[model samples]
Target: MSASLSVGARDLPRTAARRVADGLALAAAPTFALMAILVGAGGSDVGQMLCAGEQGLQIGGMTVMYMLMSVFHLTPWLRLIQSGKREAA
Candidate 1:
């Protein structure tokens, strides 16, 4: 039925959006975990590298990666919020 087809058509984007959010969550989780570990456990190493005039590129890279993933993961949630559509129960 066209009505049913229309229903499904409308749902497709939301399904895709949810899937995208889920995927981003997976990627963001490990990124933040690694970031916490690097910052917390590797603090001394990072500090030493900085004090020694080294660029500490690894730490900087991790920070950048973490921020990027967090932003990506947050995007779906922001869109969902802005759309004013309540998630299906």
Candidate 2:
């Protein structure tokens, strides 16, 4: 028996954490866009409009970042599972 070879249950909590993080990031863009649009439509001052725009951009960036992370995390797990099934066949 090889000492380094072992199989155990997957870390479900970690997977859930990653999924939640990804979801939050995905949601950030729309949330920010809505906020900016609402604020702009409310007839606020120039400063407020600028602030909202900047915030919207930041939120969109965060959303992209998180979505990328989600893809990265999910891809590997899916590949691993597929490979295992292929090997078993």
Query: In lDDT terms, how accurate is model 1?
Result: 0.67
Could you give candidate 2's per-residue lDDT for residues 42-77 as a string of tens digits? Answer: 534569668667433333444555545555445445
TM-score of each: 0.44, 0.40
Q: Which candidate is the best by lDDT?
A: 1
Q: What TM-score does structure 2 among the candidates reach? A: 0.40
**Please, what are the lDDT tens digits per residue for candidate 1 over residues 13-77?**
99999989687765675667567556644555756776887653344566666756666666556
**Candidate 2 residue pairs in backbone clash:** none
Instruction: Point to the candidate with the largest TM-score.
Output: 1
